[model samples]
Structures are given as C-alpha cells and as structure tokens.
Target: MALTVELDIRNPSGLHARPAAVFVKAAAGFGSDIRVANLSTESPEVTAKSIIAVLGLGVQRGHRIRLRAEGADEADAMAALEGLVAAGLEEPLDEAPPAAPVA
Candidate 1:
C-alpha cells in the first residue's frame, strides 16, 4: 500500500540542514520505500531518507512537498511525516541550545 501526503513548509528558513536531517531520520525509521517530490516546475523526485536529496531539490519556504511511501508501514510512515511537515518540521536540534549563565 502506498500513501501520499502533501504539506507546506512553513519554517522561516525552510527545511534547512537541521530540519532536513530530522525529516530524513523520521522517514528512515519505517521499513518502507519513502520518496519526496518538489511541487515545483521540475517536480523533482528525491529520496526521503537523504538530506542531500531533499536539499538538492531546492525546496524553499512555502514550497509544497509530497511524500509517498509503499510498504506494510506506509500508513504509519505517512502519518509521522505529515505531522512533522505540518508542524513546520520545527524539531529541536539534537544538541541542546547553549545554556545561559546562572544569575
């Protein structure tokens, strides 16, 4: 079963390195064939599990991204990815933000 989802990237910087990495990581978590496409003129197809592929597509803020997954876990994969994109892919960086000095 293959599922498709479309979402707008609302992040100011668009899907940059950090969010792209998070998106890729989330996509890779499922045992499914995941792919993403840029809804631009080229409509380029990219591997969802590759940050480079996502970046290479030149996806920017307001661009629509389509995700397709085929496998047993396709539904779950779609849901997870949909949530991420809908939430602006605003995941916290793996490294914690710099701590402030105590008063």
Candidate 2:
C-alpha cells in the first residue's frame, strides 16, 4: 500500500532549486516509488525522485503538498520525508532574519 501525507511547507523560499534537490536526493535514497503534488496550487503529482518534476510543482512557503510512496520501503521513505519537512528542509541559512543594528 502507498503511504500518503499532506504537509505544509515551512521553508522560507519553499522548495526552490536547492531544497528541491535535497528533497529529490532523499527520495532517491529509498527503493520505493515516490510522488508529490502541490495541494495549495493544485499542481499535478510527479515523481519525487526527479528534481525537475518536484520543482514543477511550484511549491511555496505555507503551501500544502501531498506526498505518496509505495513499495517495500514506502514507510521508511514517508517517515524520512516527514522528518525533512519538520526540519524545514534542514533550515536554510539564507533565510535567517537580519541582525539589529548596534545602537
């Protein structure tokens, strides 16, 4: 059976090129077949292992994305992906807030 999850994106820039690559990388580590869809934008589901397909979803911050995985390692794949989302895609450093100027 395929494991499906809908999660909100927390990355400040959404799943832009770099983070999308990370996502694809993670998905590729599993033997399961994974796919994703941008629920907020109603984007079509595409193979999660491909950076091009993942980026085509146009996922943005706060957008809801649906992930599905099927195969022997589907459970592990879903758990790994869920962890990544919870970590804000490893928390991109560029999104750090600017420091206050010294008075």
Judged by TM-score, which candidate is best? 2
Q: Model 2, range 4-99, lDDT digits (tens) per residue?
A: 999988787889988888889999999999999999999889999999899889998879999999999999999999999878777654456446
- Give the range of the ten consecutive residues with the poorest summed lDDT in model 2: 90-99
lDDT of candidate model 1 versus the reference: 0.82
The lDDT per prediction is: 0.82, 0.90
Q: Alpha carbon lDDT of residue 87, candidate 1?
A: 76
| Candidate 1 local lDDT, 31-83, one digit each (tens) | 99999998853676788999889888777777788889999999999999998
Error of 2 at 73 (Å): 0.3
Off by over 4 Å in 1: 91-103
Q: Please, what is the TM-score per model?
A: 0.82, 0.87
For candidate 1, the 10 contiguous residues with the lowest summed lDDT are: 90-99
